[model samples]
Target: MSQAAPGKSHREGISLIELTEMFPDEASATAWFEQMVWPKGKRHCPRCGCTETRKASATSGLPYYCSGCKRAFSVRIGTALERSKVPLRKWVFAIYLEMTSLKGVSSMKLHRDLKVTQKTAWFMLHRIREAWSTESASLFNGPVEVDEMYVGGRRKNMSNAKRRELKDTGRGAVGKVAVVGAKDRATKQVKAKVVESTDRATLHGFVADAAAPGATVYTDEAVAYEGMPFPHETVKHSVSEYVRDMAHTNGIESLWSMFKRAYNGTYHHLSEKHLNRYIAEYAGKHNLRNFDTINQMAAVAAGMVGKRLMYRDLIA
Candidate 1:
């Protein structure tokens, strides 16, 4: 309900009053989602990809019927919202909160805000994150900054047995997962992934996939980045050299810093099995940070198409 601070010139987001006025009810929210998902003003069949459809009977939960598929479907049928019982109004508000919150919104907070169970809120967040799994078609043009970071609970916070087990294997990054990312200096967009290891092939392959041909790359003095195909430069962090004539990986490191803040401050624990999804969510949010709040929310909705994450599969 709070408004922006005094004397701020730029518009970052809308007021709660505006949000409520825009989506005052489930019907309004559903219409807005329909507009974003089916911009042509007509619903298409997800199964048969047919545009010929009719309204369903009032008693049926499905809102549309496709003659080609002979099936009843709702706007949620093929997207991350498919089979979800939560109201569209709540989904709209959830996407709004997720995009606006700088650190991130926790499921517990979302549960209180939406009046839903904590378990349901947790699943809802994961599904919403599922909607952020958009992959960029074009590669980043240089000079791109690349870096890798380890994500997990700190070593001192681990249990005695776990600490000993990790010590037996190795010291740093022994039990943590490695996440490598890149930031395009030209477009200011970012890309990242959670990898099994930070080996030469893994790191180099990630940079190669993300950077365009003939683009210049900047990285730390990690030996894995020594033989990049593109024009490569490194800053020797081991000797406290961070930035040396536009050769620093600071841009990508800043992206990792934001992700770590969200990790440590909001979602305290991120399992390795689901780490990639979380990384994708952060990268997507970072990539779209400059857009208007409503457009960012609409992008999440648009990306929801052809994507669905079931609770069973998520847990499995």
Candidate 2:
């Protein structure tokens, strides 16, 4: 067993103490967020995109008065943090916790640490995950590993009534949800999503969306991945042939492993309706693994612009 070198984990990036020192107060946190979101130092109206905005003197919440739209808006407008009652400082702390954790941070832990209600913590987590969701069209250029996993526990472990509701009479992944993933070997970036099925069309669609044409793709012996446009290779897992030189789905398999552990340990029970959000959260963390704490936080904050999630919309 190989052990990590001493201070290996602590060597890179800002420590928790440094984070605390950097943002000692609410004003400091606000300033940091402002700098990240408005890097050009010109405050534009998020609604109208007007640069003719002035600071509101009476409002202590850093509200900006937009002369173009004649509306008063805060820095949180049009972002994931819009209309949120939670303080900016607490939001920063929650982002820090979410980014720093290797597996994930649960809403229960966030509730305890930030002194917020469980429901609020849960909402906060989902909104932050909204910030992490990527709209990038960039595809994996090099060797890409693709795989699928069934989320949720065994049907045999469910109660009789629950099993009956799901009609999960058969064994092995009958009631679980399917998620497809691809990992780029060169960039070490990952992209994953919840799929309705692991059929040929669905699997191929994911591969088409994630991988560039002419990229080498690796997977386990799944018939669904047989006829992709890219160069495809497979290892027969059922025949105990896990790896074939450079051809293996190990990278995607490792992603599923970490995702499963986080799901089982931290979240425990996940609704099928919201499973995609959870997938985005884990994938985002995996994609941003190389960034430091501040840079990670900045990256997420950058994603916040022009994205908003309402409570009603989230539930409905």
Candidate 3:
């Protein structure tokens, strides 16, 4: 995005005056980030954790030189935006656009809204998606539902010849990626992973890892998951039965609808390589749909440090 006039703020859920007060100028934003990122007074070198450091004379204003490691770094040094020449304001605006849009703001849309070239907009959004790729250790704390769905192609839509060629659903799912989902019903939180296969060994293992032991897990009567070992229950779909005394895969299934809608409505296409980051964005947003938008923005921005993504890598 073209840098905005000074004093503008893109933060959501707060008044213009409030956000403006928070980030009145470039200096203030820098200070705000420094405090937020290293509140404990230890600026561990991004390249190496060296306790002793001083500002590098080669750079102006607040860059640190780690004496122990002979490295210079700043708050953005190891973040997704580390080497990016785009201003911090664009990063803030880009994240605001990503978090606030339900379906998603396309790169084209972000290009229009942020007044940046499409290439810059695309890279920026992908980097923001990187932050959304959370390694949250928060296991599903309540009743978790696990299921798998074929994400691509309707058998009815494919050409008969092409469908015939791709009919074998074995040895790497040659056409479609097997997706596993776990949804916590009470919290309405969902987590999904792009898995290699949907075999019993693959799907069940992912479910157990994401959800705690003894959790009441529910799913459909997929023969692939007949003998699940964790307080398991199933609702057979073949007998015209979808639910029995509140047993169903509806929660995780709803997540699939939302995920597909976002991909179709905004992103238009998704590759198997980038699907997990996209899933992380949707699941994180869905899990906290009830919370204030600014809090979600903070959570995303707070994760920007200590990780890096090159513009080339995003495309590759």
Residue lDDT tens for model 1, 52-163: 9999887776889898988898889889999899999999999999998878899999999999999999999999998767678689988999999999868788889988
Q: What is the TM-score of each predicted model, taking all chains together?
A: 0.93, 0.91, 0.83
Candidate 2, 170-234: lDDT as tens digits: 44556789999999999888999999999999999999999999999999988888878899899
Give the higher-TM-score candidate: 1 or 2.
Answer: 1
For model 2, state the Cα shift of residue 275 in Å: 0.8
**lDDT string, candidate 3, 1-316, tens digits:** 1222222144236554565676667676666566556766666777777767777876554478878777677878777878777767666667777877778888899899768999999888888877667656777766888887666655566687767676664323446667888898876778887888888888778877888877888888887777776787889887977888868988898888987888778876777778888887788777656555566666677777666788777777
46: Cα error in model 2, Å: 0.5
Instruction: Provide the global lDDT of candidate 1 against the true structure.
Output: 0.87
Ordered from best to worst TM-score, the candidate numbers read 1, 2, 3
lDDT of each: 0.87, 0.85, 0.74
Residue 316 in candidate 3, Cα distance off native in Å: 2.6
Q: Which scores better on lDDT, 1 or 2?
A: 1
How many clashing pairs in candidate 2? 0
Worst 10 residues of 1 by lDDT: 1-10
